[model samples]
Target: MYARISSDVEGSGLEVTRQLEDCRKLANSLGWSVAEEYVDNDMSAYSGKRRPAYERMLADLRDGERDAVIVYHVDRLTRRPIELEQFLEALDAAKVRQVRFVVGDTDLSTGDGLMVVRILAAMAANESATKSRRVKRKMEQNAAASLPHGGYVRAFSYAEDKVTVIESEAVVIRQFAERFLAGESLRSLAAWLEDNEVATVAGKPWRTTTLRAVLASGRIAGLREHQGVIVGPAVWPAIISEEQHRRIRALMQQKAVSGRRAPRRYALSGLLRCGKCGHPLYSAARQTTRRYVCVSGPDHGGCGRLTVVAAPVEELIAKAVLYRLDTSELADALAGRTAQDEALAEVTEQLAGDRAQLEELATAYADRAITMRANG
Candidate 1:
C-alpha cells in the first residue's frame, strides 16, 4: 500500500497512518496480499519532490515482487501526469493486471477502465497545478509583506524566526567576507575555520565550497534572496556593510572571469580520471609544482582517490601523441593509430556516460529529488 501527505496537509492533523489503516482494511476485505508498504510523509506530489519509498515500491513491482498495487486513492499514488504515465508503463511491462484503491478501483485489464484511470489522473494533475498556483501566490504575498518564508531550517546566521542573528554565527559570516576581500583564498579560510574548531551550520567540517557559499550569500548581508537574486533588505540586521558585500561579490566575479580565461590550462586536461573513485582529475597547483588531483572535495563525492605529478603525466601523453604523428611507414602509423583510436573511443564513451550520470545526480540533489544521504 502507498500513502503520502504534503507538509501543509500534515499540519492539519491528517496522517499517513490513517490512509494506511484504511488501505489495509480494504486489502483484507478483498483478500488481497500486500507485498510492501510505501509511505511518504512531508512530501509534496505537486512540487515534484522525490518519493523514495514510492519509487522503491514501483521498482519492486517492476521486478515482479508484486503484481498489484493498493493505495488509499489514485491521487495518493501520484499527482503528476508524467509520473502516472511512467507508472502505467512499468505496470504494463511487468504484466501487472490490477490496481486496488481503498476509496475506488481502477481496472487495467480493459480499455474503458484504462481511459477512466487516465481521466482521474488528469484531474489529479489539475488539482496539483491549482495547489501550486495558490502556494506561489501566498508566498508572493508573504514576500511583499517582508514576512519570513516558512522553512524547516533557518538561514545559517539567523535564528528560527529568520530575523534574529545568532551572534557567533554572524561573526563567522562577517569574517568570511572580510577575510576573503583581504586576499585570503577560500582554502585558507576553510583551513582557518577547521583550525579554530569552527563548524558549519550543518555541524560539518568547513570546506572550500562551504566557505565560498557562505561568502557569496546575499542573506549574510541581511538581503532577501529568492530564486538566486537578492530582492531587498531582509528583516534581520546585516552582519557586514553593504559596501563590504559589494566588494566581496566583485572579488568573486573577478576570480570567476580569470578562471574562464584559462578554462583548460594543461594539454592532458579532462583526459585523466581517478584510478580509485573514477572521478575526473582536476589540475591544481601545490606552491610551484602543478599536479592533477581528483576533483572530489569533501562535498564533491571524492575520496582523495588519486594525485599525480602534472608535468610527467602531460609529458608522457605528449610523447605518445608525437610518436604516432612522427611514424613514417603507413602500416606502422595505421597499426598504432588504430589501437590508440579504439582506446580513445572507449575512454571517451566511459567519460561521457560517467559525466552524464554525475550531472544527473547533482541536479537531482539540487532539486531534492534525492536526499543528502542518498546522494552520497
Candidate 2:
C-alpha cells in the first residue's frame, strides 16, 4: 500500500492515515495479502521534491520484490505525467501488472486502464500549473501594494506582523550598519553578534553570509524588495535611514570590487614600508618572534633586504597614535571631518533620490505608461 498527502498544514497525518485505511480495506476485499505499506506525508508529487517512501516503493517494484501495488487514488501516487510513465515502465519491467486504486478502481492489467491513468496524470499536471500561476500572480499583486510577503518566520528587526519594529533588534541593526560603515569586517560583526548572544530569526548563531544579507537588505531602510529588486517604500518603518543603507551597499560593492581580505592580525601589517625598495613590508614570523620583511618576488616587487622586529615598531606607532589623539591639531582636523561627513550624507541622500526616480521611470516604461525617449 502506498499513501501520500501533498500538504498537511497542521502537521497532522490524518489524511495519510485515512488513505492507508481505505487502501487496506480494498486489499482485504480483493483477498490480497499486503506485505508492507509506504507513506509520504506532506510531500508533493508535482513539486519535484524528493519523496523518500515513494522512491522506496519504486525500488521494491523494480527489484520484483512486490507483485502488486495499491493506493487510495491515482493522484495520491503521482500528479506528474513523467512520474506516472516511470511507474508504468517499472511495473512492466518487473512483470508486476497488478495495480489497484481504492477510489478510481482503474485496473492497470489492460491497455484502456493505462490510457485512463495517463489522461488523469496529465489533467493533474495542468491543474497544478494553473494553481502555480495563480499563486505567482497573487504574490506580484501583494508586492505592488507594498504588503508583507508571507513567510515561516518574521524578518529581523520586525515583529510577527512584519510591519511593527522590534526596537531591540532595530538597535542591533543600527549598530551593525554604523560599525560596517566604519570599516568593521563582516566576520568581526558576526563575532560581535555571537558574543552578545544575538540570534537570528531562525535562532541560529550569526555567520558572515547571513550578516551581509541582513545588512544589505532594503527592508531595514523602509523599502519593499520583490525578486531582489526594490519596488518602492515598504509598509514597515525604517530601522536605519535610507542614506545609511545606500552607503552600506556602496561600501560593500567597493569591497567586492577590490577583493579585500579579512581583518589584519597584526597592528602594523600594512603600515611599514621597506626603506630599501620603498615597498610595503609583509608580516612574517621568524620561529616564535614576529617580524616585518620586504618580500622579494615577481608578485611583491620588493628588494627583500629590509627586515624589522614587529613588537617595537607596533609599540612606537601605538604611542604616537595615542599622543596624536590628544593634540589640538588632531581635534581641529576631526572638527573638519565632521563637516565633511555631513556634506557626504547630503550627497548620498541626493543620489538615493535620483536612483529612485530612475527606478520609477523604468517601471513606467516596462508597464507601457511612458515612451522610451521620456524614460531616458
Candidate 3:
C-alpha cells in the first residue's frame, strides 16, 4: 500500500507509525504486502506545491509500484480539488485500486469499484472545500472585527504548552519589549539578562531564540495571531500597548538591516514586490541609523501606496512568512488522539532530565580540565 499521512499528523496518532500499523494490519488481513510508505511532514493539505512525497506516491501508482494505495483517511491524501483529481487520474490511468478508512476493504480497480471510489473522493473533496470555506469566512469575520485569526499575537505561555496567561511570563514579555525599545541589541539584552542571571519565558538564562521570540511577539501589544494572521480581541490581558508593539516591530526592522556586521542582510530582497507592477521591494537600512525601506515606486514611479513603514511591515511580514507551519492534527483521528499524546508527556519529562544531567557532567569535566591546564 502507498500510505501517506500528511505532516499535519507528525506527532499525532496518525503519525507514520500509527498509519503503518493500521495499514499493515489491513493489508496483512487481506493477504497483501505493504511494499512502501510515503510521508509529507510540515506540508499543508491546502497547497499543491512543495509536497514531494504526495507527488512521488502518485507517480509510483502510475508506474505500478502497488496495486492499491491506502491511507488512514481520505483527507490524509489531499484537500485541494485539482491535486486530488490529478491523483485520481493517475490511479485511473494505471488502473490501480485504492483504500481508505471509510472504504474498509473495497476494491477500486473495477468499474463499479471506481464509481464508489469516485463518489467517496467527491464527498471528501466537497466536505473539505466546505470546511475550507467556513474557516475562510470565520477569518474574514475576524479581520473585519480586527480579531486575531492568523497567529499574530503570542503571549509567553499562550502559544506554548501553557495556553493561559501566566502573570510572571507576561511580566517578562513586557520587560523584554521595554529593553528592546531602549535601543538594546538582542545580543546585548541576552548578555545582560544572562550576566544578571535573569530567566527567560521558559525559565533559564537568555538565548537568541528566547530573546527574539519575545521581541517579535505581538502579545505584548494586545493582539493575537491565528494560523499566521493577525487577530485582536484576545481573551487575556495584554502586556504592552498596540503602539509599543508597533515600535518594537519597527526596531526589529531597523536592526534587521543597518547593524554593522557582515554585509548581505536582506530577507525580502527577492520575494515581495508590487502586486501591481511585480517589481521587487528590497530591505535596506535607513540613513546612518537602522531602518528598512520598501522601494517599489522609486524604480518606476507607479504609485505611492507601495511604501510601508519599515517596522510594522516587517513585523507583519515576520509573523506571516516565518514558519507558518501548524498542520495541527488534521490527519489524526480526533476522537482518540488526546489520550495518546497525553501519555507521552511523562517520557518527555524523563528525556529532559537525562539531557540536563549529561550537560552538567560535560560542563564539569571541561571546567576541571581548564583549571588543571591553568595551574600547570
Better candidate by lDDT, 1 or 3: 1
Residues 284-359 of candidate 1: C-alpha lDDT, one tens digit per residue? 7788887888765443435676789987776676556446435443223222233245564354344344433433
TM-score of each model, in listed order: 0.38, 0.35, 0.32
Q: Candidate 2: RMSD over Cα atoms?
A: 28.0
Native-to-model Cα distance after best TM-score fit, residue 324 in candidate 1, in Å: 27
Of 1 and 2, the candidate ahead on lDDT is 2
lDDT of 2 by residue, 308-339 (tens): 99878866765665565467643433232322
- Which scores greater on TM-score, model 2 or model 3? 2
* TM-score ranking of the models: 1, 2, 3
lDDT of 3: 0.51
User: Which candidate number has the best TM-score?
Assistant: 1
Name model 2 segments beyond 4 Å from true.
Answer: 8-14, 135-376
Which one wins by TM-score: 1 or 3? 1
For each candidate in turn, give its C-alpha RMSD to the true structure in angstroms: 21.9, 28.0, 23.7
lDDT of 3 by residue, 16-100 (tens): 6655666676667667776777776634544445767777888788888767777754556665434556877887888865554
Any runs in candidate 3 off by more than 4 Å, and if so which?
6-13, 95-105, 136-376
Error of 1 at 231 (Å): 2.3
